[model samples]
Target: MDQNLKIELGKQGVFVTTIQELYNWGRRSSVWPMQFGLACCAIEMIATTMARYDLARFGAEVFRPSPRQADLMIVSGTVTKKMAPQVVRLYNQMAEPRYVIAMGACAISGGPFKQGYNVLKGIDRYIPVDVHIPGCPPRPEALLQAFIALQKKIDCQPLTGAERPRFLDAGAQGEFPVPVPGGHDLEPTSNRGVWPVPITMNRGE
Candidate 1:
């Protein structure tokens, strides 16, 4: 503990805690999210990081454009089948102790477009999600609440060898499987005949 933070009691002291708590506290305080935004919900997400809401208040102000540097990814809009591979690829690129918050109904369940053949039902089908924010396009307040919830969840995590996020601690979880184009719906490459071949159309004919 810092000298200023150090304290003692003649009879007892409840504040005394482990280094793991200290580390978890720090980690929870300063979560850096990726700067990747998908659609309309992105507008509300941006608002949360702005002067009014000030994500800095929660210690998560830096939004890195590179997934390698980011600690959280807020999937803020619709996730179409065409975008699923890219989404999973970005998630795989993030460093350990990473998190993902599915924001808005579109990212959560495809929203009103769930009937659309090209829309992915939800992002969680491909990558593990940490938080799910509701609303077709949730207001900035909702996004802030989601971040706060994630912080609370992070506070419960262990910093030492005892426990950690299984995805990063136990062993390599491997990359999320990217979808391949071949049928009415995209299929995993592991499935037979799912691999796609290049097609060139001769419009002149």
Candidate 2:
């Protein structure tokens, strides 16, 4: 059974896995999540990572404080108009092949907060949501399930997953744009390029 169970490095004994396999394995094994928890659901997310739940077992325990180091984002609560821009910015900063888990009903569909004029209907409105855990404030067990689902989704994706990650996917062709607080509501920033701002005021100069 040892023959079938273990890998054989034929001669030098120094040989092991290939570079790409090793790289991919490291990525698949250690999914560092960005530090982002918004509302009541954030508490549940913390519990899921604590002793009893131990999200570390699935290789996603290292919750990074910096978006630059993270590849996974668990949007664990409500997304209001004011917070939507910040959320999308974080998503933009994350590396390619990044995954998002819309945890709890608020992050998924705004839950009870949906009726509030300030609440964003869904996080999907700003960034692509990979998994959605449906509950007003989903339980720790439910968050664990979301991780499993995310792992499965990651496994199915190509190694070089996203095509032209930052710019192209941000949808220059009129899709979701980073939101900004303007007047009484949020305004999309994609059209700012076309705003008639003077390159240089010449006549008086």
Candidate 3:
């Protein structure tokens, strides 16, 4: 509905809204995050829910201990290759309409540990990340900002159409392949569909 029209209708004691609007409104309002963390960034994430920061104001205060009950996963630390598979598996267990926020430089690209053999370059290599908060360990304010950004993204998603989000698209892949530990590295390196392998062409050829 148009903004002016909605206001005019309100003046006339009338209200109208589409199902899509209602659905999106509810979904964006109550995004329960999983209560899981891996490193230093977890401290900032914890602070976000405390009195001063008060993440509950956004209606996302409820942190579920189980993946099955959560819609949001805040990967807020370094993702070592050994733990990458477990993270992906947990994501797979979450119900439809799941979202991920890669909070801090560590979760986004391993931060100072990027070159370390054990640190996964980025969690997105195995699972899709909807929001990326860039900081060694992003402040609570940054996490709140990221939360609002994710809400805006949910609000704009279309309920129907080929371009609809993966959760709403039946043909979309339901589970990502969990990488297995190989001799030198995590086998497959990255999820082909989530993060496609870069292709290079030989100029001489």
Candidate 4:
């Protein structure tokens, strides 16, 4: 081959390799989460990203405070009617390929607050949702599992077909399923005027 032709082929090879690497990187880092913590479920959401569960193991630990920089928003608690507009604004601010995970029964379908006049029955009434984590306060593991489910859905999403899989299905029937890890059944912890022990961050001061 001529010297000039060889050099041109080498440059083209380098360009193709760089583009391929960038494409892979983008896919790996596609889901950037906006940390929109609202109530109890927020603690579980933080735990998922913390040292124990470590959401970073799956490339989803990037928790951006600004919606403009995020592609996923984990709505981690009850969204009241008063806050509906703000939620919509935040969802709109996110870049394309955005996703929302309603990270509690409250966010998914108002949880125990479904009868409240002030609380929004479901987040889907306003903005689109991608995953729904069912629990009054779901465990960190469950949230991480939901993240993985979200990733799978994103991967299998059709480019030109109908929109992505929606987490909430208003037409679906029955109560949200509660996940019981370690084969433990959920038992009510309190009785009338009896308070349960507060969850401590550490054992002692």
> Against the true structure, whose TM-score is highest?
3
Cα lDDT tens digits, model 2, 89-166, are 888788666778999999987799888978887787668778899987899999999888877655544434364333
Give, for candidate 4, the lowest lDDT window spanning 10 residues.
Answer: 185-194
List ranges where model 4 is wrong by over 4 Å.
1-25, 161-205
Task: Give the CA lDDT, 0 to 100, for residue 5 in model 1.
Answer: 57
Question: Which residue pairs collide, candidate 4?
Answer: none
Error (Å) of candidate 1 at residue 40 is 0.5
What RMSD does each model have against the real structure? 8.8, 9.9, 2.6, 14.9
lDDT pick, better of 1 and 4: 1
TM-score of each: 0.82, 0.73, 0.95, 0.66
lDDT score of residue 48 within candidate 4:
87
19-84 per-residue lDDT for model 3 (tens digits): 988999999999999999999999999999999999999999999999999999999899999999
Per-residue error (Å), model 4, residue 92: 0.5
Sliding window of 10 residues with minimal summed lDDT for model 2: 189-198
User: Candidate 4, residues 60-106: lDDT per residue as tens digits?
Assistant: 88889898788888999998766766776677677665777888999
Q: Write down the lDDT of every candidate, Cα atoms only.
A: 0.81, 0.76, 0.93, 0.69
The list of candidate 2 runs beyond 4 A from truth reads: 1-24, 160-176, 189-205
